[model samples]
Target: MRQPERERPTWTFLTHHARVLLEIARNPEVRLREVASGIGITERTVQIIVNDLRAAGYLDRERVGRRNRYSLNTELRFRYPTEADVPVRRLIDMFADRR
Candidate 1:
C-alpha cells in the first residue's frame, strides 16, 4: 500500500534574498518576471530583493545591451553569526547544478 503524502512546511532554510541570488547566479541575464515566476513571487518583490542584494554588496548589476546582467559577489561573507565566516560561494555551490 502507498503511504500518505507529507505536508510541506511554511518555512525554509533559505530566505527570499538567497533564492533570488541563486536564481540570478543560475542565469545572469534572466529577467525579473522569470525570476519571480520561478520563485513563486511577484516581479515587484523580485525588484526589491534585487535592490536589496545590490545595496548589500552581494550582487552587481550591469546593463548588457537592452537587458541587465547580474554578477554574484562570491567573496562576501554570510550575515548570520553561525555562518558569518562562510563565503557566499559555498552556499551557492550547494544548490548549483553539477552538470
Candidate 2:
C-alpha cells in the first residue's frame, strides 16, 4: 500500500517583520536586496518592512554618502503588552550575540 503524503506547514513562529528586523540587527549596513534574499522575501517587501520599522520609531536611517546606514532604537518596547517589559535591545542582543 502507498503511504499518504504529508502536507507542508505554512505557519512559522516568527513573522516577516521580525525576520527583517533580525536581518538588520545582524548587519547594520545590509542591503535590502540582501535582506530580501536572506529572508526568502522580495526586495519590495523588505523595503515596506523597513518603512514600517522606521515609522514605528524602531529604527533610524542615515544617509552615508552613497550608502545608507541604519540604527536601531533598542530601547523601544515590543508592541504587544505581553512583552511590554522587554526592550528591543534584549531581542537584538539575543540573536546578535549568537555570532
Candidate 3:
C-alpha cells in the first residue's frame, strides 16, 4: 500500500507567510521558486500565500523582468494567531536590521 502524504502543520503556513513577507521586503525581486526553496515549501503554496498576503494587505507585488518585485505593506497586522503582536513592517525591519 502507498503511504498517504502528510498534511502541513498550521505553523508551517504561518512561517511561510512570514518568510514570504521578509523575502519581498529584502529583495522585492525574488522568484517564487527561490522563495519555495528558502522556505521549504512548494511553488504553488508560495503562490497561494502571496495571494493571501496581498488580499490581507501585507504585500503588493508587481512584475519586473522575469521575476516579481514586491512592496510589503508593513503596517498591516498579521491575521494568523501566531506573530500577531509583531506587525509586518516590524518583522521585515527586524530581519533586515540583523544584517
Best by TM-score: 1
Pairs clashing within candidate 2: none
Q: What lDDT score goes with residue 2 in model 3?
A: 21
Residue 40 lDDT, candidate 3, scale 0-100: 75
Candidate 2 TM-score versus the reference: 0.85
Q: Candidate 3: where is the Cα deviation over 4 Å?
A: 1-14, 80-86, 97-99
- Each candidate structure's TM-score, on Cα atoms with residue i matched to residue i, is 0.87, 0.85, 0.72
lDDT of 3 by residue, 24-68 (tens): 676778788887877677999999999998888878878877767
- Name the 10 consecutive residues with the lowest summed lDDT in model 1: 1-10
Model 2 local distance difference test score:
0.85
- Write model 2 residue lDDT over 9-87, tens digit each, in one string: 4677878888888888888898999889876789999999999999999999998888778999999999999998889
Better model by lDDT: candidate 2 vs candidate 3: 2
Candidate 3: residue 12 Cα off by (Å): 7.6
* lDDT tens digits by residue: candidate 1, 3-98: 233654567888889989999888899999998987778999999999999999999999989999999999899998999999999988988553
CA lDDT, every model vs. true structure: 0.88, 0.85, 0.74
| Lowest-sum lDDT 10-residue window in model 3 | 1-10
